[model samples]
Target: MTEFRVLIVDDDFHVARVHSTYVDAIPGFTALSPVGTAALALQAVHALRPDLVLLDLYLPDTPGLELLRSLDLDTIMLTAAADPESVRAALRRGALGYLIKPFAADGLETVLRGYARYRRLLETPGTLDQAGLDRARRALLGAREPNALGRTRSGTETAVLETLASGGLLSAAEVAALVGVSRATAQRYLAALADEGSVEIQLRYGATGRPEHRYGLRD
Candidate 1:
């Protein structure tokens, strides 16, 4: 089996790092690159043509939707907002995975595992037969529900906020541990609250390394 190549495309450096970590740790995953800008992401895709592209719906230089127009690889659409319209748009555009920002890392992993299987099926004769397609649809739908540990995330967004309130600020990884979900999942809720002006993100520069991001409730 070939080492699966991946490209992480997101504006948030911290979020990209977390995703990069997950990809690097996966068993069959090969090298994964983090590209913060859409222009560079396109260039990387054209050159490497990774097995997967984790894409954000919004980018600084270009709309993510436009970037979607070009890529032919299996894409995991990353969205900051969980709006139904945005999700529907990704599906219509053939996104293999639709991840709401701060989606649980485990959840993303599970989906990727499924995608790996689905990719295998692509090599099988007549795998896309209507029956197979229906089964795949059902499987994807099943992934939409919360797992045992992730049940809390299905609760009100305010509930997620309460956990983050314990201290002044927290990284998505720290918040995910507190809530018992993947860091990615923790980020979605945090980003949403931040967008609503309920929370503020502070970039903490360290003594010797890259800066870390922490989120706190806005007073």
Candidate 2:
């Protein structure tokens, strides 16, 4: 395998550091700047043009999905937010992978290994027959999942996500009602969902009282 370079982008210093360390520690990989902001992430990609990017969807300056649309580099979203819409949106914007936050190094390593293998296979000489093309299509949809889906420790949070996905977007109270959970439980789930990469938290303007933060599927 050839030398692989990666850029780690996240708002948290420790998250970036830990991810960067795990990436660099992999043999035959060279890690470039592990940056903290969306701007720095873009700069690193443009200047260094690393082979892969471990991206965070939430950044201090810009919405993470927008950045993915503008860049030409291969990227994987590594984030705490697990909003289903966000996950689908990132994939639509052309992110190569999405790994939810709180992932261990083992998950990261599994993705890296698969990506590396894919890269190698990609470089191999090939002639595309109809069968080969058809096979490729079959393989593509099954491609995003890592070796396993990381278990989410929060159950109410998962139920809340299901509700939001069902309704497209819902106010906190609506979410609470749909999930058949208490308002406080719904609020906790929303925060947890925001952290897990499954749901998006946005403020709905022109609300009756308390500018309601609407829960939407991440996009």
Candidate 3:
């Protein structure tokens, strides 16, 4: 599977690291080194060519909205700016999503997964019919049907559970390969299951880099 690259643009080093960790934790997505200024962001975009950018509204060098207008790449505003005008300006400038700061990991994950689905839907071959077009639009809008905390499961979700039952501990990518779904899709389901206490996550430390997350049925 082709990895989706993400660039995190926040002036705060701590916040940027947190966002980068969240992006890396999700399957099928990788985070590039974050930039702290609009100028650096511009240079990074030109050099790295990331698939999506998590942007902040305020920067020391330039306003993020100004930077947004300058960027042709896909972006989602991740900032503390909650003013209606800022929100409207961001939407008007073609930001894919806007996330208020101090948000939980799940909130960012939801948007990232939705964006992934949106891209997949629209990037497919052939012209889209009305229904297909609507689906793509909804995905872009991050419209998700409420699932009642593992009370009910889709066929794919059940397959993921069964795969874990047999395979012992496995990473999201491994589960995806076993269940015949995208890594992002598998990670979404696994996250939901983990949230409901149906599954447990183990962090495996390596000699270098971040720890790997492996999931299994909770005993």
Instruction: Give the 10-residue window scoring lowest on summed lDDT in candidate 2.
Output: 139-148
Once superposed on the true structure, which residue ranges of model 3 sit more than 4 Å away at CA?
145-219
After TM-score superposition, the amount by which residue 167's alpha carbon in candidate 3 deviates from its true location, in angstroms, is 6.7
Weakest 10 consecutive residues of candidate 1 by summed lDDT: 140-149
Q: Which stretches of candidate 2 lie over 4 Å from their true place?
A: 129-219
- Return the candidate ranking by lDDT, descending: 3, 2, 1
Candidate 3 per-residue lDDT, tens place, 1-219, comes to 236899999999999999999999876689999999999999999999999999999899999999999999899999999999999999999898999988998889778767876776677679989876776677677664345333577899999999999957899999999999999999988876654446666676699978788989866
Candidate 2 global TM-score? 0.60
| Best candidate according to TM-score | 3
Q: Whole-model lDDT, candidate 3?
A: 0.85
lDDT of 1 by residue, 96-204 (tens): 7687877776777666655654554354465378855654554444332222124444474656788877867788888888878888888877755543335556666
Summed backbone clashes in each candidate are 7, 15, 0
| Top-lDDT structure, candidate number | 3
